[model samples]
Every structure is written in C-alpha cells, then in structure tokens.
Target: MANIQYVTKEGLDKLRAELDHLESVERPKISQQIAEARDKGDLSENAEYDAAKEAQGLLEMRISKIKDQVANSRVIDASQLDSSKVSILSSVKIKNTANGMEMKYTLVPETEADLSKGKISVNTPIAKGLLGKVVGDIAEVSLPNGMEMKFEILDIKID
Candidate 1:
C-alpha cells in the first residue's frame, strides 16, 4: 500500500502541474525521439533507439510514481490547523537551550521542504522531536554526530 502524503493545496497543485508536464511535454518528446530513431533503420544495433527506449522507460516510471503520489495525497487545511502545539504546517520559533541561538522554522511535508526558506521536513530529527510539543516546552533531539541538543519552543503559529 502506498503511504498517504499530507500536502498543502499549493503543493498538490505543483505536483499536478509537474505530472501534466511529464505526460504532455515529456512523453510526446520521447515518442518523437523513438520514432526518429526507428526511422534510422536497423533495430538490433541502433544505439539511438536503445537510448530513446531507456529514456522512455525511465520517464514512464517517474510518471507512474507521481500519479500514485497524487492519488494518495491529502491536502492539509492550514486555516483549520491549531497553533497550540508543533505540528505539520506550524511555524515554530525555538531557541537552542545550550547556545541560546534562536531560529524559526515551518514544519512541512517532504516534498515542500526547503531549508533556505526555513521550511523543514517533518521527517527530520529536529522536527520529529518538536512534534506534539507545545509552546514553552523543550525538545531533545539527537543529531547524526551522536550529540544531543535541546530546543525550547518559544512560539507556535500557523504560517
């Protein structure tokens, strides 16, 4: 069974647009390449034909996977989200307990995670530790370097 992914309406629209591009633009382009390669003659020894076929297979597989993801996806209503606790789509402000450094991050789905934009994937250790934590609560997270860090939740909001 495929996992049901929770996404925002914008994220779902992006996925749908990407799938549409792959099916309409990419699929037709690959078909044209295969047809051109076939026109070049020999079937068994044509490298162009082989390459095009391989590309077509990869494109189809990607399309299928995206289709499945779209089918299993559920859009999260940000307005309905509660700000009482840290959860997906929550913009949380936290302070490093040890260093006294403060940082703000929004917990988002994997597909929507962009660290440069302060969006962190909910699957990340920090987000996992922060999950279900209310404002003023402390979260202890273990890093990949085997070091433990604590963060104090300063505020929680839906962004």
Candidate 2:
C-alpha cells in the first residue's frame, strides 16, 4: 500500500507542476535526443541512444513516483491546525535542555523539508518526539547516532 502523505496545498501544487514539466518538456526533449541518436547509426553499439534511453527511463520513474505521491497526498488546512500542540504545519520553538540552545522549525512533509528554511520533516526524530507536545512539555528524542536529547517546547503556532 502506498503511504498517504500529508502536505500543504502549495507542496501538492509544486509536485504537480514538477510532474507536468517532466512529462511535457523533459519527456519530449529525451524523445528527440533518442531519435537523433538512432539516426546516427546502428542501435547495436550506440552509446548516445543507450544514454538517452536510460535518461528517459529514469525520468519516467520519477514521474510515476510523483504521480503516486500526488494521488496519495492530502493537503492540510493551515487554519484548522491546533496551536496548542505540535502537529503537522506547526511552527515549534524548542530549547535544548543540555546546552540551552534554542531552535525553531516548521514541521512539514518529507518532500517539503528544507533545513535552511527551518522546515523539518515530520519523520525526523526531533519532530516525531515533539508531536502532540504542548508548551512547557519536555520531549525526549533518540537520535540516529544512538544519543538521547531533551527539548523543551516553548511555543507552537500554525505557520
């Protein structure tokens, strides 16, 4: 079964746009390349033709995957999100217990996660631990490196 991904409307639109670009622009370009390569010589040992075919295959795979994601995606309404607890689309401000370091992140789907933008994937360890947590709640998270860390939730807001 394909996993149902929860995404924002903007995220879903981005995926759809990408899929359209791959199918309309990229697919035709690759087809042209394959046709040009085939006109060059025999197909038995044509590296250009082989490369073009491989690229087309990869592009098709990407399109298929994106289509699947689009089909299974459910867009979350930002206005409907609860600000009292950490959840998808919630911007959370947390302080590390050990060093008192503070960080803010918006919990999003994996496809929309951008570390530089302070958007963290919900599947991430810190986000998972923070889920359903309210202000002043302490969340214990186990990192992939086998280290445990504690974060105190300072605030939650729909962003």
Most accurate candidate by lDDT: 1
lDDT of 2 at 70: 97
Clashing pairs in 2: none
After superposition, the stretches of candidate 2 with alpha carbons farther than 4 Å from their true spots are none
Give the alpha carbon lDDT tens digit for every residue of 1-159 in model 2: 879988899999999999999999999999999999999999989999999999999999999999999999999998987889999999999999999999999999998999999999999999999999999999999999999999999989897
lDDT of each: 0.96, 0.96
Write the residue-wise lDDT of candidate 1 on 38-157 in tens digits: 999998999999999999999999999999999999999988887899999999999999999999999999999999999999999999999999999999999889999999999999
The TM-score obtained by model 1 is 0.96
